[model samples]
Target: MIIPAPPAPSTPWPLPRIKLHIEDLDHEGAAIFQGAVNARDALHLAVQASYRWLYTVDNPPPKVTQILLILRSMPGVAHTIGTGRDGMEKEIHFSLEYIVHSKARATAEIMGVLVHETVHCYQHNGKNTCPGGLIEGIADYVRLREGYGPPHWKRRGEGAQWDAGYETTGYFLAWIEDTYGAGTVSKLNHCMKNKSYHKRHFKDLTKCSVKKLWNAYCCLLKDDDGAKVLEILSARDDDD
Candidate 1:
C-alpha cells in the first residue's frame, strides 16, 4: 500500500530494489540494451508509468518490495514473474534476442516492454482467476496510456472478442476511457482488486453489459460513416 516508499521525493513509485542480471554479457543485444537505456532509470520509469496510469497518489500501490531484471538470450521479448509464494518479489526476464531484432526502436521498445511487464507486476490478478487476455490487455493498456505504444499499434477493428488481448482490447478499453469518462479503466482495475472477475462487473459499472458493449463497438467499426457511428455509440450514456 502507499507504494511502500519513503516520503523523500527521489522517485515517483516507491523505489524498489532493482537487481539486474546479464546472463550473456557477450550477447550483442545485451550491449545494445546497455547502450540504449540506463538500467536504473528504465526500471524506475517503468514503475512510475504503472503508477501514473493505474493508481492515484492517494490510493495504495501494490506491495512490490523488489524487482529482479534478468537479461538473457531468451526467445520472447520479456515476461514478469512474481514470487510464486509471496507475490511481492517480481522477476522480469527480458530476451536479448528480441532486443537485437529491435535495434531501430530499441529505446522505445524496451521501455514499452518494461512498462507493460511492470504493470503485470503491480496490477492485481483477481486471485489468479482473471482472464489471461484481459490481464495482458490491461498491461498493454497501461503502456499505451503512458505513450509508449509502438508506432504500429492502432485502434483495431472489433473483429475478435474484446478480450482478444494485447493492443486490441487495450485500444478498446482506451476508447472506453475516452468515450465514457476518465478513470473508467481505473475503476475497472479497482473492481478486480478484491473480487473475482465477472461480466456482470462490467455491466454494473457501465450500465451496458460486456456483450452489449462489444457488440456496439463492433457495430461502430462496421459502419462506413465513422463519425455518425461514433455519435450513435456515444449517445448511449455509460454513466453508472
Candidate 2:
C-alpha cells in the first residue's frame, strides 16, 4: 500500500518580505537565473526548507523581517549578511561568476545555494558564539534535507573534526537525526537558541557526547559492508 505524504506544516511561520536585486540585468547569469527559477517562489521555498528542517510548528521562528537576494559579481559562491537596526534584515549575496561557471548544473546549484544561504538567515548561532563550521554545517544540513545537495557531496568515514562544516558535518547531523529519531537536529538547534555553544548539548539530546557521537559515526562507516556503503552514498544530485 502507498503511504500518504506527510501533511504540510500546519502552522505557517511568519515569512519575511522577499526582495531581489540584480547588479547587472545584462549579465548572462541574470538571464540564466531568471530562466531557472521564479525568484519569489524560489526564495519562499528556501525559507520554508529552513523552517521545516530546523524548527517545528510549536516553535516560533526568529524575527527576520525581510530578505533581499542580491546577485552580483563576487569572488565566492555566496554569503549572507544581516542588516537593519536590529539585524533582522538579511541580504544574500550570490556570485554571478560562480553561477556562470556552473552553467551545466546552474538550476540545481542555484537552488541548493539559495537553500543553504537561507538557513543562515534563520538558524540560531548561540549568540554568535557557535563554531563557524557547525553553523555552516547546519546550513548545509537544511539544504541536504531539502533535497538540494550537489553531485560532488559524499558521505565519508573521516574528517578533521566533527564540526568540519558543510556536507561533512551535514551528513553527520543527518546521521544523528536518523539514529536518534526525527527532530533530533531540530532539538539540537533549539537547545542553542537561548544559550552559548557547548558540546554538552549533543549529550543532552543523544545521550552521547559530540566527540563520542562522531567516533561512533566513523566506526559505523568503517564497519559498513560494500552494499551499506553504496546505500550511504546513494543520495546524489539525481535523487533530487
lDDT of 2 by residue, 29-99 (tens): 99889988898899998988887888887765798999999999989899999999998999999998888
Distance from true location, Cα of 191 in model 2, Å: 1.1
Instruction: Please name the candidate that would achieve the greatest lDDT relative to the true structure.
Output: 2
In candidate 2, position 228 carries an lDDT of 56
Name the 10 consecutive residues with the lowest summed lDDT in model 1. 1-10
Model 1 residue pairs with clashes: none
**Residue lDDT tens for model 1, 1-240:** 012322322345566889999999999999999999998899998888777667765555787989999999878788888884787899999999999999999998999899899999988778778899889999998888777888887666655888989998898787777667766777788778898887677767777767766767777667756676555545665532
Mark the regions of model 1 whose C-alpha exceeds 4 Å error after superposition. Answer: 1-13, 224-240
TM-score to true structure, per model: 0.87, 0.89
Candidate number of the best TM-score: 2
